[model samples]
Target: MYRFLFAIDKEISYSDLKTLLKKGSGIVVDVRSKDEVDKGRISGSIHIPVENVESDMSLDSAEFKSKFGVAKPSLDSSELIFHCQLGRRGAAATEKARSLGFKNSRNYAGGYKEWSEKEGK
Candidate 1:
């Protein structure tokens, strides 16, 4: 169990993710491929493959909602947490998000593998 009392700049641990999910305090962005995501994913996560993250983020609110079924996150929101099957692509997405002015974006370093194994998902 972990208690996160501050914003994570770039990386987040599995425990931190669990805490965030429990609190419903962040957006968990799944940057995995469509096939990978279809197999399994963290419930309530929004999917946007790593390659499309930048363009998707640029979509206007209505277009974004129409495409993703969720409102577009503001560029400055600190709750954009990106993850993939493993951490590599997630790190890339985190970099892209930060480059696009999402300064508080973070990556789940332990990834879905850790999440599924630990959470029995």
Candidate 2:
């Protein structure tokens, strides 16, 4: 059920992401490493490095909760967005999240670089 919905690849633009952020409508995940995130990141985004994303892990798994400190979004959540330093990692993370049953997950293609430079993060 959930898998069918998220099977499609979706990309979110920076502007749309800003709107979503202001609305507080979804979860934003940063897929950068700790060192990169320690430098700076999008406000309100959860830190989950790409390496930590297990392809076989389910969103409801205890391991996922322990790692992110939040319950995984239900299959219907369209607000699950992922980003990274440049975008590649974020895309990978999005794929992982989808594989984990987050069918509505999306990748912020502009990433932190574009977000900070253009949006003055």
Please report, in order, the local distance difference test score of every candidate based on alpha carbons.
Answer: 0.89, 0.81
lDDT of 1 by residue, 26-99 (tens): 88999999999999999889999999999998888899899988777787777789999889999999999998
Clashing pairs in 1: none
Which ranges of candidate 2 are over 4 A from the true structure? Answer: 1-9, 55-69
The candidate 2 region of ten consecutive residues with least summed lDDT is 1-10
What lDDT does model 2 reach? 0.81
* Per-residue lDDT over 88-111 for candidate 2, one digit per residue giving the tens place of the 0 to 100 score: 998888888787777788999999
Clash count, candidate 1: 0
User: Model 2, residue 83: what's the lDDT?
Assistant: 93
Question: What residue runs in model 1 are displaced by over 4 Å at the alpha carbon?
Answer: 1-8
